[model samples]
Target: MDRLHRQVGAVGLAAAAVLPGLSAQVDQHAAEVRDLLGVRGRRPTLTALASYTDGLLDGATGRGWQPPQHDLVGWAGADGVAVRLLALCALVTSAVA
Candidate 1:
């Protein structure tokens, strides 16, 4: 569970920094993350990330993604999950801004 805690904290920190200026609307920040992960209205933990990615990409592929892979990241060998996280992190940045 320690690793999960760390992951959550890291995500939160990344969110905070990406938020530009600090504010106490943590719940709002959290809501944005959930929405990006497509897991809103529920509490999220580390493990939900992989499942979320799988679900999101499942539909994304037919739209131009090619699946167990995609060109979203443009990296020759970056795994799908990594691409998902990068996308999710980027979404979080946008969600708040």
Candidate 2:
């Protein structure tokens, strides 16, 4: 019984440690969705926004499985527009996350 109690306590402690990270993930995703929809200042319609954001992120991840490579000039063109775009996305994702 003592061992079982110790295991339960450990499990509870582990959950307490992890819960905040899970909450932050949710909040960050919400912020990203808001930014994506150009609705940062306006009130969000939660139901629709959640679904739209999920679809958008899912499609984005599905399309790009690999990270962008470091190349001075590539498919993004000689101007490096593609590289810049990827950088912007990473910045936003980190900021929101």
Candidate 3:
């Protein structure tokens, strides 16, 4: 593989390794926020998910999140997760509408 491919592969591996953990954390955060805000749903609407993710980004939830220590090459932060979540929300919102 070329340098770029190698780098991409490494990042992909890292993401694959961390995804389960990240998913668990995201789930926990969403559940806590939902409970706090009295949101009643197993599956939240895209708008509500976006709103909760906005709370995560804006610190409205008053909780701090730190990604795992295994260096995601600048993708290792709560902001990264929030951005990805927002993208997911947008994707789903567009698909649903």
Candidate 4:
């Protein structure tokens, strides 16, 4: 039990140390995505995109349709597309901050 605890502690420390680098990478990627979408430096555009995607998800849920578990990126249909777009908006906003 003691050895297991130490192993877990070490793993946690390692993860903690890596998190900042991971965050920076994510922010960089988000900036790239925002640029590709032509929303860079345009807060209004990003906000509108987020709102539209949110509405799409809400509308689908209102109709009692289930989003596919394996297609969170929207490869399957409308549900996934909305999720992916919303995520992109979120990433862009986070990067901007």
Best by lDDT: 3
Query: CA shift at 46, candidate 1, in angstroms?
Result: 2.1
- Between candidates 1 and 2, name the one with more favorable lDDT: 1
Better of 1 and 2 by TM-score: 2
In candidate 2 the C-alpha lDDT for residue 23 amounts to: 33
lDDT of each: 0.45, 0.39, 0.46, 0.44
Ten consecutive residues with minimal summed lDDT in candidate 1? Answer: 67-76
Worst 10 residues of 3 by lDDT: 1-10
Cα-based lDDT at residue 48, candidate 3: 67
TM-scores of the candidates in the order shown: 0.31, 0.33, 0.37, 0.32
- Tens digit of per-residue lDDT, candidate 2, span 1-97: 2232232223322332345643344345556656876778554454544455346446655877333342322222211222223323333434445
Query: What residue pairs are clashing in model 3?
Result: none
Name the runs in model 3 displaced over 4 angstroms. 1-19, 55-97
The residue-by-residue lDDT of candidate 4 on 20-70, one tens digit each, is 543344346455556766778754364555554457557866988553333
User: Highest TM-score, which number?
Assistant: 3
Q: Per-residue CA lDDT of candidate 3, range 1-97, in tens? A: 2232243334534453467654454456555655655764644565665565556545633566542233454333445454344234433433366
- Can you rank all candidates by TM-score, best first? 3, 2, 4, 1
